[model samples]
Target: MELVKIYECLCDPTRLRLLHVLAQGPVCVCHFQAVLGEPQVKISKHLAYLRARGLVGSERQGNWVIYALPAKPSRELQANLACLQDCARGNPVFKRDLARLKQIEPSCAWVRAGEPQKAPGQCRGG
Candidate 1:
C-alpha cells in the first residue's frame, strides 16, 4: 500500500481510535459499538472505510461479521500500527478504548439458531 493512502487513513481521529482497538484482535460490530459508544451506522461506516483501504478485513461468523487487522499487513502498515499502539500509551481515550474492549462481552447472536426450549429442563436427581 502507498504511504500516502496509509497517511490519509490515519488522518481521522475515529479511524485512528478504531485501529487501536482492532490491533488487539478480531471483533464484531457489536463489540465496536459497545466500546466506542457510537451508533451502529457510524461505526460501520468507519469499518467500511478501513476495509476499503485494505487495513481491516472481515469474515462471516454465524449471524455475525467479525473484523480484524489485515492478515497480510505491509511492512509500512505494521510499523505505523505498532507506532500508533506505542503512541497511544499516553492517550487516555485510546487507553480507555482498549480497556473497554477487554471487558466487553461477546455477542450471543449464535444461540438463535435453535429454540431456547431445546435446552434441558432443570436437572433432577436420577
Candidate 2:
C-alpha cells in the first residue's frame, strides 16, 4: 500500500540510478546531472519524487545542494536497498555513471572513506 508507493517512486531507471549514486555519499545537484548525463530539469524532477517519498535527504553546502540517503534507514528499507544495489551493480548505465562520478571530485566526508578521487569535469558544482 503506502510502502508500495515508495517502491514505485524508485522504480524508474533514472531515479534508481540517482539512488545508487547517493548511496555512495552526498552529491550536488549539478554533479548528479553530470554523472548521470541527464538534463538538469529531469534530475530535479526525479529528486523531488524521491524527496516526497522520504527515501532521501538533502543539504545545502555553499551554493550547491547535496543529497544522500537517510543516516539510519529502517531495517526493512535497508535490506530492500541492499538487494537493489546488487541488481544495479551489473547495469551498464550504473557502471557508466559510477565511472563518471569518479572523475568529478575527491571523496568527501559525505562519501565513504577510502573511495578514490573522481576526475575533473564529472561534476559541475563546487
Candidate 3:
C-alpha cells in the first residue's frame, strides 16, 4: 500500500520485467513461465511477490491461475504501472518478453481427452 514498498518491489529486474509483460493483459502463470523461460517455482515466487505488494491479482481459470493487475489499484500504482509500460517500449528485455508472449501457444481452456490445445484465444469460436 505504501509507495516505498512499491518502489522496493520494483527494484528487482525480474519483477520489473513481469510487470511489463502483465501490463499487456491477464495471463496464466504458465504463460509467464514459457515467455520468461524460468522454472515454475521462480516465476510463481515472483508472481506471489507482486501479489503480496498489491501490484497483481489472480483468478482461477479452470485449473490455471490467471494473474492480472488489480481492477482498482491505487492511483499511484496505476501511474507507476503506466510509466513502467511506457518506459519499456525501447528496452530490449521487455521487447523480447512481449515478442515471446505474442508467440506463446495458447493452452486448451478445457481438456478434451483427445483434442490438441489451440493458441490463446483460439479456443473461442471464430
Candidate 4:
C-alpha cells in the first residue's frame, strides 16, 4: 500500500482502535461493537473505511464476517502497525479495549460455532 494511503487510514481514532484490536486477532463486527462499545453501524462504517484502504481485510464465516490485518501487509503498513502497537501499550483506552476483547472472545458466536478451521487471526476462545 502507498504510504500516503496508509497514513490516511490511520488518521482516525476509531480506525486506530479497530486496527489495535485487530492486531490481536480476527474478530467479528459484533466483537468490535462490544469491545469499542460503538453501534454496529458505526463499527461497520469504520471497518469499511479500513477495508477500502487496504489496511484491513474480511472474510465470511457462516453468517459472520471476520476482519483481520492483511495476510501480506506492505512494508510500510507492517512498520506502522508495529509502531501503533508499541505506542498503544501506554494508552489507557487501548489497554481497556484489549481487556474487553479477552472477555468477549470466549462468547463470540463465530468462534463458538466452530468456524475458521483455517481462519487468519483465528478467534481465540472457542
lDDT of candidate 3 over 1-126, digit per residue (tens): 489988988889888988888887777777787788788899899999989878998877555677888889898888888888888888999999988877663343333122333444442222
- Cα-based TM-score, every candidate: 0.81, 0.82, 0.80, 0.85
Specify the highest-lDDT model's number. 4
Q: Encode model 4's per-residue lDDT on 1-126: one tens digit a residue.
A: 399999998898999999999998788887888888888899999899999988898888765788889989988999999999999998999999999988877666455454654444434333
* Global lDDT of each candidate: 0.76, 0.77, 0.77, 0.84
- After superposition of all CA atoms, the RMSD between model 4 and the true structure is 4.8
User: Candidate 1: what lDDT?
Assistant: 0.76
Model 3 TM = 0.80
Clash pairs detected, candidate 2: 102-118, 102-119, 103-118, 103-119
**Clash pairs detected, candidate 3:** 106-119, 106-120
Q: RMSD of candidate 3 to the true fold?
A: 6.0
Q: Which regions of candidate 2 fall more than 4 Å away from where they truly are?
A: 107-126
Q: Across residues 87-122, which tens digit of lDDT does each residue of candidate 1 receive?
A: 999898998888776665323323223222233422
Question: Which pairs clash in model 1?
Answer: none
lDDT of 4 at 70: 95
State the lDDT of candidate 2 residue by residue for 1-126, as single tens digits: 666866896779999899888877778788888898899999999998888887888876555567888889877678778877898877898898888888775534333443334443334634
